[model samples]
Target: MNPIDPQLPPGDPLVMLGLLASAILFAVGIVGFLSRRNMITMFLCTELMFQGAGLAMISYGRQHMDLSGQVFVIFILTVAAAEAALALGLVVLLYRRKETLSAEAWKELAES
Candidate 1:
């Protein structure tokens, strides 16, 4: 089936597959973010979640024969780049303070 048919019949298997894959990616990211304590690990998980969101958007846009998803993806990529820079700075400062990347180390900063 052509993916951009503009009128995908209901219960399109390809679209459903795309949605499932996106959901799995998002779920893994959430799990990683919640279970990991390392600052860099959490940042990576957040990036994973962003990618999952982008995939979902793209899948829906393709299903609807629209280009808005590409635009949103560009925006998402820009934000992700900014986020990476900010995370890098924060990680450097955090490491300098304690020489560790664990989130638990942040409590010292909060208490002071």
Candidate 2:
């Protein structure tokens, strides 16, 4: 009993849809990264990029029936968690110093 019906051939529509979704997510992330002035929003955009990467990886893994891609996604998620922690810390520090969360406020560091 082959699970995929062995004779029907592999349907790739899911893979294509996953790729398309990943592309959309990546594009949105890029746009947000470029246009947003809030540090929290920027960090969220970065996370969106990571999520897109993870989706792409999982889709690839499913298409190939391999575990390595999923393992890579796990590693990416771990790194993303660490990045979020660091980014939140920076946000708190910046807010304390500037009393604002706008990206423009970061220029204060440059002048000093």
Candidate 3:
């Protein structure tokens, strides 16, 4: 039996709500990322944005009753996991080198 019910979409209220949530999440992330000066804060914001995108995909998939969106979300999650791991490692390395987590400190590295 097919798991996903084929829902004809003139409009699904749930889907609309999900999309709205996704947009809000992405917007908040963007604003946070832009405003934060700390490396860790910036990474958290980026992760938030990634989650927003994944939510959007899930919402879209539900609207269309297709598995493709869910499939993409799986990939998105995979990438997010890898990104978080790498970001943590980079943050640790950079912090040890600079003794500070501020994004502005990167400019000093450019001069060398």
Candidate 4:
């Protein structure tokens, strides 16, 4: 016998809530990434988007009684870590050369 009731639909209240939360998070991340001029803040906004994605994956995995979403979340975590490290390195280099975290400083580097 199947563990999950085949009669049950995927659009249950719990899943709907999770999906809505993820959408909101992604929207906030997009807004923050667009509105912020600081390099660090922009990178953090990207991370926020990743978090929303991870949460959505987990929720969907649970809804389907599958493990793939959890596995994908692990991959997402790995990528997020790598991105953080690279962003930090870039921020340090940019700060050293321009003494500022504002992304506009990058333009000066190209012009000079």
Tell me, by lDDT, which candidate is best: 3
- Between prediction 2 and prediction 3, the one with superior lDDT is 3
lDDT preference between candidates 2 and 4, better one: 2
Tens-digit lDDT track of model 1 for 1-112: 7576758656667777877888999999999999999999999999999989888888888888799987899999999999999998999998998999999977766856
Deviation in angstroms for 15 in model 2?
Answer: 0.5
Q: Which regions of candidate 1 are displaced past 4 Å?
A: 1-10, 109-112
lDDT of 4: 0.89
In the range 1-112, model 4's lDDT, one tens digit per residue, is: 8487778865567877887788888889999999999999999999989988988998898889899999999999999999999889989998998889999867755845
Write model 2 residue lDDT over 1-112, tens digit each, in one string.
6476778966889988998888889889999999999999999999999988988998898899999989999999999999999999999998998898999976756856
Q: What is the lDDT of candidate 1?
A: 0.90
Per-model TM against the reference: 0.85, 0.85, 0.86, 0.84
Clashes of each: 0, 0, 0, 0
Candidate 4: worst-modelled 10 consecutive residues by lDDT? 103-112
